[model samples]
Target: MERRVGEQYRITSKEIDQYDDQGYLVLKNVLTEKELKSIDPIFDHFVAGNESEKMGKDFCDMSQPYGTPIEDFQLVNAMLPGKYIPSFSKNIFYRIAKNIADQLYSNGKAAMDYEQFLAKKPTKAEAEFSMHQDLGYWPKTKNTWTATFSLALSDADVINGCLYLIPGSNKETELRSHRPKEYGTATNEAVNRDDSHTLIIESKPNDKIIHLPVKRGDVTIHDERIVHGSGGNLSPDWRKTYIIAFRDERTIAEERAIGFTHSHNDEVDWNSIIK
Candidate 1:
């Protein structure tokens, strides 16, 4: 059964154990129909190429470099929707995510680290997000409690590009090397060049990649260090997703001290930029 707007979804110890072992968990029917209705229009507004004055960042192609033409783009994303749409933070989905995150934390406390909105346009074969760990994009920090909650706004399947993850990859103590997709053989210093936002790691031939397909309202939670990515949307329907991440407050401060900012930190006047 789906949870109501104000109702919370209880997280079981078994689920926590599973998350600890596999580094990911899928909670089905976490959001009710009413809650979906409230947020659908907000996502649609961005997906349709509309911009709001309050939005901190504009949607950009994740598959290509920063200034790639819109028509040539495949997967597009907007970060920190809660910054522009206040209701997004107040939604039941966010509350349930927090509840689950609190349970996963050793100290029983968690704070909002960041959030994002992503969409895979229909039939975009090159829209796939390559395999990489979330910590690969973050600044080096001691915190390891961070987790990301991905809420699907539309049905996701193999045909429409669902999430794929390597089981137990989070067990690795060290982060693998990652580089910008554009710089095929360039040094890690190429990441500082800032030409491309997409960073990827090479997948091993023996890695066990599992595809997770879910209906709208299902939420998938994954550890920050998990090796994960999604395929391109080949079906006619769009695959839209909302992501909220949480971590210990101390880690958040450490990341800030290192001058690390999310890709969505760029605030722009939408009306002026979008005609």
Candidate 2:
């Protein structure tokens, strides 16, 4: 959780106020093209290994873990020591997590194991993700113990499945949606009725939006109840991102049920980022 120079990003008071009020924040240019360029190809190599000839498949099949092959395949589980560690992924976990811990929470450290580098591509039968909080999948809690850092690897647009969020929705009481009954589960979708509550974060390449589109290294520290979701990818290219989900010590057990653990003493492998 200690800060590192060249990796530390200071959150301003104004930005903090805005994030507290709006439920999200965007940090632009956190990752330069040089950084992204180095990592993208490595990730592409992983995706290529599991390339499925079945182009229209709903999700990555047994061939791919997340519709993209694994770059540092060994890093999938943090408990094991692995040889696959991409520089970008490693720097983000150590530097970004440390910066956030230094700037936001005192006496509390950010555990960055429950994170994933995600790649979402359009399929023949792609479905829109339902509006829900990031914490929707976890057990209920009264305290704020978790947040997410979503870094978009490509230009995310409505035409190609941009991420949509209910701004300030994080401030409201938590609401639960029924679990997807099964694969291709039916979702009771509804319109966003409150303008003040919802705000869509449509992003351009290298233009980061917190909780969604962050520069290669730009991280978003959000409240657990932030209302967030994404539209299906409409673009021909895939939407790639590295997500580092951070949590407090008390919440570690609950997170482990979902399969995330640290790599060392108070340290999570940078490659352990998951969905």
Candidate 3:
């Protein structure tokens, strides 16, 4: 069940208005060391299938393997489960979501969902995420609002390939404006922004920054339109993070009908992941 807005938490009018206009917001240190450590076992259990590689830093691969006929645990979100529930009975995820909901919507209903990526930054293979917004992958014809929350499992900095953002660039529409499918090819928006003047998010462990150095346990509340992505990890350490998507319950049905589907544990789950 989703948490109630006012009942669980509250967001100031100022914060809500800022997110509405800017398309993204960064909340620092939303998680404590104790809170983050509680999730370590779940993450380690999931990544146990993959062999960690050593270069300059200790990291694990979470992305799809290059040219392989074998099953890559890195590409499968289903392999890692339960750690993403956001809020367990004593966990803070639900509380975090409640606060976000209260700020984003006065009505205050936050729906928690799956966790994606138990990613690790590798040394030899620098981690690189294409510049793009979560909204780009969804059906563009539909007029609606959705948001994704990314919780960092490790400290991210410029050397660690922290997230880069073009302030207010979320206002630009890739799906709305007519352009070649490759419009954002160079500036994928998922990895890097196309506009000038980029902002690099520098963060500390348990100290979260939205759309920037995705800090461990720092919940990033972003409008689907936010133009953001991170460069490859240059540091000698791996950066691990979890991503969750949520939206208003009113749009739940529509999101399910048109959103992408995922196959899990030999069964196909449709539209359930979107809401």
C-alpha RMSD by candidate, in order? 6.0, 10.4, 9.8
- Which regions of candidate 3 deviate over 4 angstroms? 1-10, 50-80, 83-91, 107-109, 140-143, 173-211, 258-275
lDDT of each: 0.78, 0.48, 0.49
Best-matching candidate per lDDT: 1
RMSD of 2: 10.4
> Model 1 residue 186 lDDT?
48
Model 2, which residues run further than 4 Å from truth? 1-5, 49-89, 122-127, 181-221, 257-275
Q: Taking the candidates one at a time, how many backbone clashes does each contain?
A: 0, 8, 20
Which 10 consecutive residues of model 3 have the lowest summed lDDT?
Answer: 51-60
| Candidate 2, run of 10 with poorest lDDT | 74-83
141-191: candidate 3 lDDT, tens digit per residue: 244566666677788766666666555656765432211122233546533
The full ranking of all candidates by TM-score, starting with the best, is 1, 3, 2
Q: Pick the candidate with the highest TM-score.
A: 1
Write model 2 residue lDDT over 1-275, tens digit each, in one string: 22235666666777767666776667666666776676576556444543223222221321122323434221121211111333434554445555654565554666654544445545412434445565554444334556566666676656555566766766766354433212321563432211011222333254323335433445455556666666665566676655666667666765465453422222223223311
